[model samples]
Structures are given as structure tokens and as C-alpha cells.
Target: MSMNTLPRIEGPHADGADPAGWCDATRAYLPQSTWTGLFPGGSATSAAKALLDMQMLLPGEEGRFTRRFSRAVPGRPRLYGINVDRVMVYKAG
Candidate 1:
């Protein structure tokens, strides 16, 4: 619940990619435990930040939206974009 720490994202996380391609890609990786926490409601700033983080949208001329999440290191906080539900929505262009 901070002013501008990190924004929760919105939208679909995956699109125009091989959906099942990532399945066997991690075949040789070790498995670890992960926990999830969901904050359904948040502040305006928080929501804005979340929208930015999720959208990862760049400032444009007008009201054009463009961006997409990444597959590589999707959870890295340094990168900003929308978290399309459970998936990351990175900027496309």
C-alpha cells in the first residue's frame, strides 16, 4: 500500500507465442517451492503503478497501447509491465 512502489498489471499475459513451447523448455531445470499472495484491492497510486508495471507501456503520441510481457525471467521486478492475471504482460513495441 505505497504511493509508487510497484504497480499491479492488468490484461492477458500470453499472446502470439507458442503456448506449449515453454513446457519442455524447463525440462532440465530443478523444481522449487513457490507461494502466491493476491491483493485484490489497492490504492489509486498502487493501481496506477500496477497498470504501468503490467502494461509496461511507453509514452506515445496519443492513446495508442503497445507492449507485452517477457518469457525470459518474467518475474524480475526491475522490468515494468502488466501481470496479465498469472502471466506477465510485457511491452510489444
Candidate 2:
């Protein structure tokens, strides 16, 4: 995807603020172990990396202001609650 398509929106802070939103958004879909692995510290940096590594992120950057564009992991099986296929994850850190 082109850089222009990636939204420049900032995400929740890298610190442990508003963690419930992040967890609620991601954890239910991922296996417990996988969820733990991706967000051991519950930080936005980890969220960015996980989304990028999964090939869900486009690309852009700056200081603590990195940008990531992500969509749901398309073919991943739903391990828990509802499928998040329509979810689009955006993280900036």
C-alpha cells in the first residue's frame, strides 16, 4: 500500500494508559499465548510491531510518532468471540 493511504492518526500512548481498549480490541481473537506474546508489556510499540509483522501495517514514521495502518488478519481463525474481520487497527507511537 502507498504511504498516502496510511492514516496519520496517533494511537493510545505507549504507556499503560487505556489498555482495556487495546486488549478488548485484540485479545479475544488471538489465542491466549499469542496475545500474551504480542503485548507482554501492553504498550503501543508492541501493538505497532505485531500489526506490522503480521503484514497488516503500511508504513510511515517519526520520533514517538510512528504510523501503522492495519486491517484484521484476514484468514486467521476466530479462536474466541466474534470475528473481527471488519476491524481496522491503527497505531501511532
Which candidate number maximizes TM-score?
2
Where does candidate 2 clash, by residue pair? Answer: 64-93
Q: What TM-score quantifies how close candidate 2 is to the native fold?
A: 0.24
lDDT of 2 by residue, 33-81 (tens): 4445645766645765655565453333452213232333222322222
Candidate 2 residue spans exceeding 4 A from truth: 1-42, 62-93
Give a tens-digit lDDT track for model 1, residues 1-93.
121322223323354422211212111111111001122334433543455555432322233222233445344222222233323223232
User: Please, what is the TM-score per model?
Assistant: 0.17, 0.24
Model 2 error, position 25 (Å): 21
Compared with the true structure, the alpha-carbon lDDT of candidate 1 equals: 0.28
User: Where in model 1 is the C-alpha error above 4 Å?
Assistant: 1-42, 56-93
